[model samples]
Target: MSLNFKDGRSDLKRDSLMAEEQALPPSYSVQPPRQEAPEDLSARLARLDLRSSVKNGMNVSADQCTAHLKLLEAFNQLREDIGQIPGLFGIEDPIFENPETPDTHQHVQSPQALAKVRVAEKRWSVYVARAVARFEKWYSTCVPATMGGAPCNRLTGNQFCTVKGLDRVAYHGLPIKQLTLPDQLPPLDVLMVWHSYMLNPRCFFEDCFRYGKLDFFATALPWTAIDPYIDIVTFEFKPSVQAVENFETSTGLCWSNLNDGMEKTFSCPRCLSTISVPWTQGSLWTIANEMTPGNGFADGDFLAHCRVCDTKITHDYLRVLKFKADVQAFMSPSDTPLPGTLLNKDGQPGKLTVLGSPPESFFPNSLLNAGLSHRFLLLLDNPNVSMSDVRSIWEQGLTDKNLVHKAKGVRTRLLPKERLSIRRMMSRYWFNSSPFALDLAGAVIRQGSFVEKMHNIDWLHSPALKSTMERLVQKYQRFFTLMAENPGKVAVPTLDVDLAWHTHQLNPLEYYSYSDKMCYGKYIDHDDKIEETALSDAFTWTSKAYADKYGEPYSECTCWYCEAIRESHTSKLDRFFKPNKVQALEKLHGVEVPSDPLNSPHISAHNAVRDPESEAKQRVKAAELDKAYHKACAKAKKKGKPEPRRDDYFYYYAWGYPMYMPLYYPYGVPVVGGGGFYPADPCMVNTGAGSYGACAAGTCGGMAAAGGACGGGSGGCGGGCGGGGGCGGGGGCGGGGGGCGGGGGC
Candidate 1:
């Protein structure tokens, strides 16, 4: 009844031979509407999966109840008018299921479900009142730089969002909304969405930073391992290098995972504590790769050579880095000055001059023989990041493989299956389609390479990439032709993104990892060999200190696997959990490392309360404490910020304070007030979340530049809420797959 794999081709067998057999449900008669509301778990599950049956909008799992709930919440928010306080907020009956009883569910369609949505304009007012209270209070102490409706400020705070008119047509034909968020979310949703997806200052602050509507930023696998070692550049790439993440499902941007130039978190293997930073793109630089401006490190070559380790970091291991900057501006440009605007191009804000002569193509022959995604795949696996071997493969594509045996593009590889795996990863890699990374996407994947078999990636960039890159030659003057460059000597530009390569030990796979090509069956092992999996748990955090420091500890963990285990347990089995206790995530993605919560001391907390109902919910929770810890720890290491509570659970309380943002809310008290917390620095405005609107004044997002002093300053006095039902559903608040991988099994 299903497809089968044969000779690497997807083939399916059909049992029915009739050419046109129209099928009809045996029970098509419309069942009378239930007179009463279904309150049991069985009823709830039947109602849920029936809705889940909708086609096309898949969330990679059948159990997307929370995502659905979040979506419904978003819909309720949207149905209400956020422009006025009276028109915000709403809610509906929570949907759930229990294995104890699997039958008798009420299958409610959208019309029925929408009808069930209860819009309490009063309820929304309560939420808005609370938000306004906090927001207005935040405005009293500092200023906000609002541009295009999104604003950032130490007082206004980092990543607080409001609708600037995504619905309103801009001069350009593009939509106003940038990241994945529910349609027409209320003011609070906007605030959380902005912080969760854009400005997460939690890494440095203790529990003072809050998460957003969506959880991707928290579990964005890449940052887990990468964030601990890098520092986000205050400035973007030189006017158009582009971002590394696509953030298509959500309108947001992510930092790069490449070792180009960011912070590096290297540690002394013996002491297992923080070590002196040897790399930085700005000012201080001790890293060998950083010292060598254009010549990036050879891919397959990195000697761990930590004075304590005194050896190679090994091919199986990678030292990753992460840079935390507010990249929301890069999603779509605002009404900022163009000459001054730097968040464009294919990659980041930096410019990549191919130096002398850009090769007409890096691997022409290999490219001709292989798929587009495989091109970047080859780059990830290559021992040397140079272009010589790649050029040789292009030349050999017309001849034989002997002369070009080096790790050329997929075209020249002996293990074509591995090539396919890399190709597949590239097709779905999160950062491929963001407008910022379009050119780099072109560089990574060839046109037509992902036809049908991939995530249906965009191919429109090829021609544009070629055209834009072509201008670099004329811009630099006399750089020969694309093919005339010296293949043996490649010139790499400095991006200050060098931290991308260092492993933070969080969810490494969440960001991206380079691995050798292999068959699907073997690829898993190869992934393990590269061990690019995210490292969570206190151990990894203790060394690099990531995710939610001092918030919640992974219950069990000797290695990073512990966090993954927790994520799995929380996702699908919350019902089975014992009340009021946490679960340990003792599983891991890689075999070599023992990153699991079972080995941790915190497991005792959850073990005393485990039950069948909560089995799955625990797994989805790993992203919380572990994920945030890595990002914050890495950021702290980069700036030499004092490291305090990288592992304390109490820290999560401060995230709601507005002091952290200066562009929009623009206010907060010193460390003593506002719940015993303060901003990282007064008006520190260049993080990716704080960048776009943090510097602009009288913009759609705010009325003043960050730190410039807002007129209605209300310094930390927030509104109160009268809880009740939310607005009707379908506001798009929860449709963005914003839920945690909160329902997985161990």
Candidate 2:
């Protein structure tokens, strides 16, 4: 199968049984049953109430009782504020003056209540300050300033810098040396090998949300499998702090034994543009100071791109080495940098300490945070704006900065109606991490960007965003071959039944070694393997590594960063499959919902009681670049003027797009100006590395579940693999490989 890197599009037909067979995925999606909770339940909750989860979530704090009391007081404070809003307006009765109130009330801003609100505002600030302080304090407890094996370059947000050389930082199963063992490799295994190789980064993101390997996969990963890991440690301090010491501690590296034994390798120069699989052996090898196998691959073997130098090296001269470092950490809650724990250096970390590195913000972290940081601030800035209007404002802001042109290409070719199901059927289409993850610029806004001052992803790489062309070429090849053999048939990528049993995953502390005796042979010749990992919850997410490093053993989170969220969306069966159908039937018994928000026919009567101005009143402006981004969801259900721009290939994902979540757009791609979206402003672009679509980026502060690891927040590096599988030529994308994009340096 020839894997073409340039614009490889699928040729499979949708609705065809053959395509259906090709597109079927092992069931994975398991969404929350639509529980009809009272609409007022959310309205009654206060931000203070949510913050308590962070405190009382674990037994670590002995004052659960106190935390509860504080939270309730916060809640009462909110209620009082609501009651006083009318009084502040000098109205005798709020309900009588405004009988047509929208069921969903937004954050109420009563500047008139300024005199009465000061105390609460101050308290809220204090609470936030303490949380930030605790996070920093707890962080220093585990990380060292000069920590080696830090998850990233330590310079850019979401970007990881290679260990200066290949040998020193082969975190994945990348063989950094130039030696090899002779053997004939299987083609299928080769494909599988590439898939596993790509899984390194994706699994890293998954595991972060998943805690570690225990919860990530059903089985434990080999103790030393070179699984990819994201550096999750970042800290910030107030301006008053005279000195800022960003600390990191790590102890993962290989020296003499691994480095000296490694041999140089070469491959087709086009490998840069090709998908590499282990199906084939090294064209050449040298061991024991002798030329072994055939001569190594020539200069045409591959291209090595240095993200930092922006330099490309021909494969002919690519040689990487191994060098690892170990460091310890300690942080002080007070202004002064507490003496570091390492006995080697006095207070400072590492052998070489650079004085005056300047202060970096831990909360508005530029190192690892994805989209949540800036979008959260957007909400704070535009407390009055409706969700949809905020999106419009945000999008338009990007246009004013002239950043949308890159993304303006029509998504007509990407998952068009005729190909929607076909694309969905593609076996390797990973949704959470594919283009979305690679486009970390869209994930969160970082500090220190001048061109993109709003929310920049300066370290993001175009190739990385595209998963370095890894899965893209592979999927294209499969689709190409399938099209050649079956014509219009697109096959669904099913999971191995055994995947549920072993549930082994690629985690940073471990690498996956395909057990020969326990092979994933479900997809043998002419056989369809249906995986049941999601359906069966028999396995335990037990991990000593996670307990020591993070805390929880296993947790199930449905948020954007959740690996379960990433995997759940992988299968078509999961996408359209009916779960608990029998239960649904028994409960409904043909009863009709008179006012289902999701039901189409009940719209007329539903609107009669709805507030007409609920949306407009909610229209608040977004901070950073003010692109009317929140217009869509603003109780207003308002529509932005349609721009001349084209929707993304995956725009329809928005239909089922969770209401409160934000959507980060593709990287290197600029937003186009026009209608059916925000105006053609590009300030959003200049505002950051790439622009984050308003809604997807906006709705945040959602509680992070115990097991959730993949959201932009980094306890570790985070980004889903490029595709949700279904790589077979679905589009110019691949799933797995490179979690949501980090900074540019690789």
Which candidate leads the pack in TM-score? 2
Candidate 1's error at 206, in angstroms? 25
Provide TM-scores for the models. Answer: 0.18, 0.21
- Candidate 2 lDDT at 465 equals 20
- Give, for candidate 1, the lowest lDDT window spanning 10 residues: 716-725
Local distance difference test values of all predictions, in order: 0.20, 0.19
lDDT of 1 by residue, 17-92 (tens): 1111233111111223454763343222222221212111111112222122222233233323332233222122
Per-residue lDDT tens digits for candidate 2, residues 1-746, read: 11111312223232221221233221111222344652332222111121112111111111222222222232233323433343221212212222332221223322222222322222222222222223323323322222122222121211111112211121222221111111111111111222232233332222221121112222222211111111111111111111111111111111111111122222323233432221112322122211112121111133344343333443212211000000001111211111111101000011212222211111112110223224434443332333234334333433332222222222212112111111111111111112111212111111001112111111111112222122222222232223223211122221111111111222222222211011110000100110111001111111111112222111111111122212222222522453333233223222321111121110011000011122232132112101322221221133242221211222111111111112221111221111111111111211111222211132111110000111121211111221111121110011111121111000
Give candidate 1's error at residue 18 in angstroms: 62
Q: What is the C-alpha RMSD of each candidate to the true structure, in Å?
A: 31.2, 26.8
lDDT, candidate 2, equals 0.19
